[model samples]
Target: MKIEIWSDVMCPFCYIGKNNFEKALEKLPFKDEVEVEWKSFQLDPTLHPDETKTTFEYFKEKKGVPETQARQMIGQVSQMGKNSGIEFNFENAIITNTFSAHKLLHLAKKYNIADKMEEALFIAHFIDGKNVGNIDTLIALAESLGIDKNGAQQALTSEEFNDDVQKDFSEAKNHGISGVPFFILNGKYSVSGAQPVEFFTGALQQTYDETVSPLKSLSGNENSCDADGCSI
Candidate 1:
């Protein structure tokens, strides 16, 4: 069974969903058989490079929410992150264009280190508050995962992998995905949001059974909805 996740690195719920999915996999009976793919999805493609906006400031200015309310929301997200063994430091988080980071992820995927890179990028942005949008930081993180630093730097500097990243984003749009953390199981069943571990575990089991038995329909009689934020 293969699971493709379309998510953004800056998305807090996506990180939570990733952790939850991993936990579910740990307990899964066929954990080793399952293949996971991390696809790219940018929350804001038009984000500028020179923009030095803090997450708090960005939310406040873009959403017109007061600073206090934004801080409260960040606190809530931070606590939720703590529950998943993630230390979220909202104070140091700086919002930047993630297109380059997504490109690096594509390179990591080619090296079979996509999952590790995803986790590291999430930690860099949300926990350590490192500038994941920067090429230097991305290359350093990739090198830490045994990826060739020179290759990573060249890939980052060049336009290579840009088309792959864009293709994934375009495919997500074609699937009507308007949000991060979207999960597509075996290209049949789809789940959205940071659902509970039980949900993911059940999905994996169902996917596994369907893959093993071709006579079974994964969705059964359930109606599949478009990606307009509908419940599964």
Candidate 2:
């Protein structure tokens, strides 16, 4: 089974959803049979590179909300993140373009380290107060994850995975995904938001039973009769 997740690195719910999905997978019967793919989705594409706007300020200015309300909203989200074991420091988080970061994730996928890279990028921005949009910081973080720094640097500087990232984004649009943390189970069922672990476990089990199981041939034949058994 393949599970594709479309999310943004800076999105709090994406981090939480990642943890929730992992937790659910831990108890899944076919956990080892599952392949997870991370897709790219930018919440704000037009953000300037040099912009130093905090998350609260960006939401306040873009949504026309008062600063106080924006802070409260951030606090609420931060508390929710704490419940999921993520330390979110929205006050120090800088809103910038994530196109490059998404491209890096594409490269990470090739090395089979996409999940770790995604988690590191999220922590760098939301918790560690690092600029994930910066090439230097990204290279350091990738190196820490055992990725070749030179290769990572070249990948970031060059347009290596630009087309691939855009393809993921286009696919998200085709799937009518308007938010981050969207999970597509077995490329058929779609679940949005940071759903609970039970939701993920149930979906995984249901998909496995309906599509991946060997007994699927017995699904729609209530009146059928076999050589050894007969039913009305």
How many clashes in each candidate?
0, 0
lDDT computed for candidate 2: 0.88
Lowest summed lDDT over 10 consecutive residues: which window, candidate 2? 213-222
lDDT of 2 at 148: 93
Query: Model 2, 132-168: lDDT tens per residue?
Result: 8898988998899898989999999998999999999
Highest TM-score, which number? 2
Q: List the residue pairs that clash in candidate 1.
A: none
Question: Cα RMSD (Å) between model 2 and the true structure?
Answer: 3.1
Off by over 4 Å in 2: 216-232
The C-alpha RMSD in Å for every predicted model, in order, reads: 9.5, 3.1
Error of 1 at 200 (Å): 0.9
TM-scores, one per candidate: 0.89, 0.91
lDDT of all predictions: 0.89, 0.88
Model 1 spans with C-alpha error above 4 angstroms: 213-232
